[model samples]
Target chain A: MKKISTPYHHGNLRQALLEIAVKLIRERGADALTIREVARRAGVTHTAPYRHFKDKASLLAAVAREGFEMMVKETKDQFSRTTQDALARLKVCGIAYIEFAIHNPARYRVMFGTGRPHGKNSALRKASEASFGLLLECIKECQKEGTVRPGEPMEMALAAWSIVHGFSMLFIDNQIREKGLFAADRESMMDVVVDHLYAGFKPN
Target chain B: MKKISTPYHHGNLRQALLEIAVKLIRERGADALTIREVARRAGVTHTAPYRHFKDKASLLAAVAREGFEMMVKETKDQFSRTTQDALARLKVCGIAYIEFAIHNPARYRVMFGTGRPHGKNSALRKASEASFGLLLECIKECQKEGTVRPGEPMEMALAAWSIVHGFSMLFIDNQIREKGLFAADRESMMDVVVDHLYAGFKPN
Candidate 1:
């Protein structure tokens, strides 16, 4: 491949490739993503992407990692804006999760969809764990405040994560719409689902 | 295209095509599913599948419908064999849900993963609703037995459904393994998650 003149240096090339890849996924779906296409869209030489990402899978992993980081930031931003009540802040984080998935369905799918497993030490896996760790912190805070029942915080975090994650997947995948349950009112449906979860975590 | 005669009749031909399509998806990913490939694998002429499916999307919808029916039957079978305690039965169904997804990851992804939306009256949509309706019935049963708190059965069902569905997706997608959360003992992790959900639904 002939080298093309471009302004992007080695440092910015990876970010350029990821941004272009995300655009392709958002507009045409993940199947449309190809290293060549990303390079073309980025206005960089075909070999440029190769320098940063060893393969398409590596590029996808990087995108997924970016997605996880964005989710953690989004959730934290939501959490910070809410009341200090542990339960209330947790609810806010849960809602933020759903909203983020709703707004970024393609990215969300890439983040959680079928892909090569990133090993424990991989940046992608670490980013994902960091996002999950936020939820664990919320669960622990709720326990400390006596709002949530005492139990394994990891288990409680898993429960809360499952509810939100499941609901988001269903909503994004059009299952909720197909069922005609809360089809016309998604916000209220989310509230009801979260309320049930809140009740579930309350001290008996 | 020449019409190729086979052992299957009209009704059986549809089933054969679906089976072949499912096999292709299982071996390859969903993107590997194409009308021509399914027809070739089914030992029929390339045009034969068009007679039953119209297009690739239609064929995928049929497969998804079959998946939903199978899930409903699987859950019902487990529900019937469990003890009379509503909570116990609900747990059985939840476990059944996870097991089914773990065993049939490809079909489960086809059923719940991103795809063209099935309209309200579509068979695929109806089958999915029927599956979810079974969960609602379990929540109602728990309410009758005074195991679960009395509330909107729909909301409670959504809560229960979210946790199980989310956990199954995470497990099947290899997110749990990738994060090293429950690498050695997935079964135990599943139990803990379900137990928390069970406690969540109890009357406070």
Candidate 2:
């Protein structure tokens, strides 16, 4: 194999490295990924990756941070695209979360995996908090609109998160398919599942 | 350091290997677990592990199978301890599931991780089916008792599974604590979460 080392500019170099790292993690599981291997794949000197990533953990943190941002963006885009009520918009956000997991299982795994960034104030941690904050905000909106039951918004948000996140994991892990619960239509299946959660959230 | 190679009977050797494998997985995570490592830790010859486990995948499959069986037993034991109604027993079963994940995060991860056994007919797969089947039966009983709303038993079961499973994953992954959502009192917290799910399952 011929090594193609293209000289990348500083800004582009980091982007290229991250892109390569994401690709490596996707092709091989995160445990198999390494800074040196990513550099090798990028056709750059082994030390080049060190300029951006101190170690594998940092690289994974960066990947997770990117995942959270992208997820937030995608979720927001989906819900905003619809002119539905707050509860309906929240359902759209749930669907978006699942779709993100389906489309980017590798990134999703890293984002939620045990190896995700730690500490309460790390960039990755903050990004994750923001991701949950998105849901909390939606729950509050639903409550304000009187579409959802009155309760602690955090607890309500968590109930919704549990349903969507759990379904995503089951779907991605092939458990749903293995059980033959996932017939051809994923959207409709999720629609019903989300409605079941909404039933609990409905105002009396 | 000195090595201790305590000879073991055939049946005991397999059990020892599994126990060591589980310990190794808990300490270093499943990716770092190897049959050779288990052998070394067990003070047995490397080749000896092959007698029980054909490879790493098979070793993990055995671990996952054991995890499923243990989970089913624990959930049943907890729910049966109380002479509660069907829905109450089902709630108890959900609590048991989360407790199992909390106590055996490593084993739980292995049971649900990507590296779990493949193929539709494997023993591991059957064990997982039976695990879900337990939940399905609980939902069925709840329906028969007129506690749960009428619907496809499988869908209702999936709805219940999603909440507990999702909550388990979040707690095990430390996301709950990271978000400050888990303020100690795991059982109470789980109780409230499971109630939200029950809100959806209740008949109108």
Candidate 3:
């Protein structure tokens, strides 16, 4: 392996710091991650991170933006490869969302961590909107398929988001005890959750 | 009220410390909480809390236990008041759970913040199980009503847990932007989530 020499001009200093910071966050929980530590691990001066991120919060926002975009892509890809039925594709999206969170728990936390975004940082917000848009599109397809009720897709969209987001959060937070939950049990639960979501919608 | 100043020989120093610690946690965030601070607030020696709580983790577990017990009562009470069928009552339980978290954000965080139980104390674990048992009872009712699918109720239990828990977590973390979500909107979202939950369970 070629040695990437240690130099101040590492071409992609912002990316470097963010990458190391994420690794640190994973190894040590998000609350323990620090700017000084990220700089130290990235072989840059503590102050060097300032050039890329004004503060840890903004750096975290950037990490969230990246995570959101990745999730958006993964969700869309999962939907595209699934069966033609909108209901099935939507289930795939839920599964994919959970899978993404499981795959990148650190990024998941960064994306939805303690603070809310302040302003029109449309790049980050757009990624979030795009991921949500995928779910909305799938719900629309459900309406078209006559499987989901046509009125107020927003209700369905919010419902889907809450359940998927809820499932992932439980898993990430380790609230789901595997001792009580079987390997095969998860699929059945998902079935009940996704399948049961149609109960209240009055179809058009 | 006689200001008998909780003397050095006061009855139940342990309970006193826990009470004051919870108060501090409610007022400020967890990071600002310390055993010494708690002891000081309790008007006791810094070593006093150690006699009752082995460490900070033990104290946190104690706090979480209090929160969990509150949830169990709230859930049971929510079901108790409603004259609706089993499923409708279960929805009330879900709302109560979210309400508990929303109203007591700090306590809710301590209950679900860590991946694992910080203390080896069985009391906290029991309290947690007891609260979950409420949900289990609700799921069993759903099963009886033939509203939930035939399978282990644990998954559905977890899914229900996740939707409300995830929503509460986001709302507590303030990730749900004020721009799009109002208090009324949250109620509507909850309605959709609980309704679809029944949909997910019923026969196709």
Candidate 4:
């Protein structure tokens, strides 16, 4: 095969490869992606992708890392813009997390999918930790402000994460809309769900 | 290829096919499953599987339906055996759900995986509804018994479902233990998580 070296060789080849790999994942499900195919799409030599991604799993790890970083960025953006109290602000972050999943379903799957990079990738693992860490920090603030009940911050954060993550998965799978389970306006439904998360339904 | 006649032909062929399909799915990921392969493994002619399942999607649909049915059975088993109240009963069901996911991760994945059977399968859809219906029924009872705060039963049930489902996904994906997010004993951890789910930490 004739080698076609494009401007990507001169300009940030690693970033270019990740961009194309993400595009491929979005277009086709992750199951069919290959490093050779990513290189072909990037207009580089078949071997060029190897310079950045040793194999398909590493390439996917890079995509997952990018996904976590993007999620943290979106959550932080919401935190900065919102003026609500700690618990309420945490709700805003949850909304941001769900919105991120809604806008990027394919990438969202890769971030949490079973095939995600395991113990081998520290960068990917750190990115994953950072995303969850944002929620942990918010819960700590909520407890400190007396808005949330006192408990281990990590456990409470996991509880909060469960609701948003579950809702996002169900929504992306078309389970929510197709089943007509919660037909109320989407934003209001999330608000109500968050309220449930804040105040569990146990009668006072 | 010569067709091998087996007792499954005279017995319950459909059940046999489903069993074989489940085994294949467990052994190999769902992506590689095919009707012909299943039939071949079942000691039947390639076209034999077509009699029960029209295509690969249909075969997958049957698998998903079985998963839902099995889940309902497991939940009901706990209900009959436990003496807990409505809200507590629901927690038992939730624990059963998480346990099912932990033990049968592959089947659990297929029950909720995106590529699962869609509009074409009514049996599959109803089976899926029945599983959620159990949770909704529990929430309705919880409301009646004054254990849960009054709200739209579906919405409350969904909140309950989201937490359990999200936890299951995270656990099966190795996110929970791998990160040491919940280091306590498994059952006690679930109990605390369920409590957080029941009584959200909002200060009175």
Summarize candidate 4's per-residue lDDT along A1-204 as a digit string, tens digits. 745554444467888888887787678766557788878877778888778877777888888899999999988888888877887778877899888988887788778774332676889889988988898888888778877767777787778888888888887777777778657987887777777887852333
DockQ ranking of the models: 1, 2, 4, 3
lDDT of 2 at B148: 94
lDDT over C-alpha atoms for residue A193 of model 4 = 72
Which regions in candidate 4 have their CA more than 4 angstroms from the true location?
A: A1-13, A28-40, A44-48, A115-117, A201-204, B1-17, B24-55, B115-117, B200-204
| Residue B149 alpha-carbon offset, candidate 3, angstroms | 4.9
- Position A87, candidate 4: lDDT: 73
Q: TM-score of predicted model 4?
A: 0.85
Model 3: DockQ against the native?
A: 0.40
For candidate 1, the docking band is medium
Q: Write the per-residue lDDT of candidate 2 for residues B27-86, one digit (tens) a residue.
A: 888667888889998888899988877777788888889999999998888877879889
Off by over 4 Å in 2: A1-11, A32-36, A115-117, B1-11, B115-117
Compared with the true structure, the alpha-carbon lDDT of candidate 3 equals 0.75
Worst 10 residues of 3 chain A by lDDT: A195-204
After TM-score superposition, what is the CA distance of residue B109 in candidate 4 from its true location, in Å? 1.3
Better structure of 3 and 4 per DockQ? 4
How badly does each model clash, as a count of residue pairs?
Answer: 0, 0, 8, 2
Candidate achieving the largest DockQ = 1
Local accuracy of candidate 3 as per-residue lDDT tens digits, B132-182: 778888889888887666766776777777777777876676555533555
Docking class of 4: acceptable
Query: What is the two-chain DockQ of model 4?
Result: 0.47
lDDT of 3 by residue, A1-204 (tens): 654564458667888888888898889888688999999988878899999887877888888898998998887777668757887887787788888987898888777654444355667777887887888888898888887777666657777777778877666765565325646555665655554444444353
TM-score of each: 0.84, 0.90, 0.82, 0.85
